[model samples]
Target: MVTPVRVVIALCLLAPFVAMLWVGSYAKVDPVFIGIPFFYWYQMLWVPLSAALTVTAYKLWQRDRRGRVAAAPASSGASPKGGASE
Candidate 1:
């Protein structure tokens, strides 16, 4: 059941958590952005980035759910190999 779309969705949702949790990567004062420190700016940047990623994941989830829902009836309606009884 591990599909490519599910993998992409997991990555999208995991990115922000990984980016924020890895403090050493952005724990700096140099490369200031319009007076804001790199640390602050980097963290703030993820706000929108996280939102976008979450939206993307949600849309993908909905699409995947729809596909599964559509396929469910077709799968369940089938008769056994011995055929159905009248």
Candidate 2:
């Protein structure tokens, strides 16, 4: 469980949760805020949150790839040009 991989999983989990919250809040029949409507804010808020979530996921994916590369083992065998029978 690399940190980056963990972060990616967290972000994937968070996006849907946040979206649900926004949807639920907007679903109220009246859907009003202090002055603005819940419907408007909920949708607008998600636009930025969606971008943030995407960026977070991308960053985490890159970090995970870096970790995998660092942990990769060296190749164990010679090339075919060596031409020897086993």
Candidate 3:
């Protein structure tokens, strides 16, 4: 079942890709940032943005994986010794 948390994680991973891929949106030289052209500065801004988004996605994935593992049921016949022989 797809959960809200999974949807959020997907957005986190997709945001940077969508922003960076849409080059034409920030292809202008106006709205300069600290003397840097919008074209260059815009792309540079995503460097940090992408890193933060990627970290968030990774952390969310780890949390989800841990939750799944914890919720799994153990085998009924399994022994504490893992069925090992003396």
Candidate 4:
């Protein structure tokens, strides 16, 4: 069930977690940004970055799902509304 698209989607979803989990890498007061320390700015930076990555992952998953749905054979007996009709 694994595909390149899924792998990319996983990476997109995991990048922020990996970045934020490695706290030692950003635990520093140097490299201030307009008075904000690297530690604070770096964590804050991931807010938008995480959102972007999450969106990317979601889009990729959606594309992958669409591909699978298109490739699969349609069910002939299924009704559009799942309602019994005369």
Candidate 5:
């Protein structure tokens, strides 16, 4: 089942990859910021953006994992009583 939450998490993880891979989109020297060229600043910006996206994805994955574990049946922890049966 493709839940909306899974879709959102996928997008969160995909954002950084897509942004970094599309180099030509931001490969420009104009529109300098704080003496930094667009190309440099654009790549630098993704550092924090990637961090945020990774954190979001991590949280979503943890939540999904917890839900699955909670819904699953509990396993018996008891060991076999007989050591050597004749």
Candidate 6:
């Protein structure tokens, strides 16, 4: 929710995508597997990696949410009528 935390989360999410692009662009890494090109294999590895990253991000988000909820102060008896000023 905080600025730096949000930036870190964004970077974490984008890292695998950048890695995928970098690996996919390589034209010279050879040695085919099951008739597929080496380039395909290398890029395909990101499938599971992406999934792992998603799980990691989800876990991190959950922990962040829990921490925020725990740290939040209890609601007072009287609620504010409308939006608050920054």
Instruction: For residues 55-83, write the lDDT of model 6, one tens digit per residue.
Output: 87777877776766565554633223333
- Model 5, 1-86: lDDT tens digits are 68778999999999989999998999899999999999999999999999999899899988887776566554533223313333
For candidate 3, the TM-score is 0.80
Give the whole-model CA lDDT for all candidates, comma-separated.
0.90, 0.66, 0.83, 0.84, 0.83, 0.70
TM-score comparison, 3 vs 5, better candidate: 3
Best by lDDT: 1
Q: Per-residue lDDT for 1-86 in model 2, tens only?
A: 55747866687758757776766656653656667777777777777777777787778777776766565543524333333334
TM-score of each: 0.83, 0.59, 0.80, 0.84, 0.77, 0.65
lDDT of 4 by residue, 4-36 (tens): 998999899889989999999999999999999
Runs in model 5 lying further than 4 Å from the true structure: 73-86
- Kindly state the number of residue pairs that clash in model 1: 0
Q: Which of the predicted structures, 3 or 6, would earn the higher TM-score when compared with the native?
A: 3
**Model 2 RMSD vs true structure:** 7.2
TM-score of 5: 0.77
- The residue pairs in collision within model 6 are none
Task: Assess the local accuracy of residue 35 in candidate 2 as a C-alpha lDDT between 0 and 100.
Answer: 73
Error of 6 at 32 (Å): 5.0
lDDT of 3 by residue, 14-44 (tens): 9988988898898899998899999999899
Per-residue lDDT value at 71 in model 3: 65
Ranking by TM-score: 4, 1, 3, 5, 6, 2
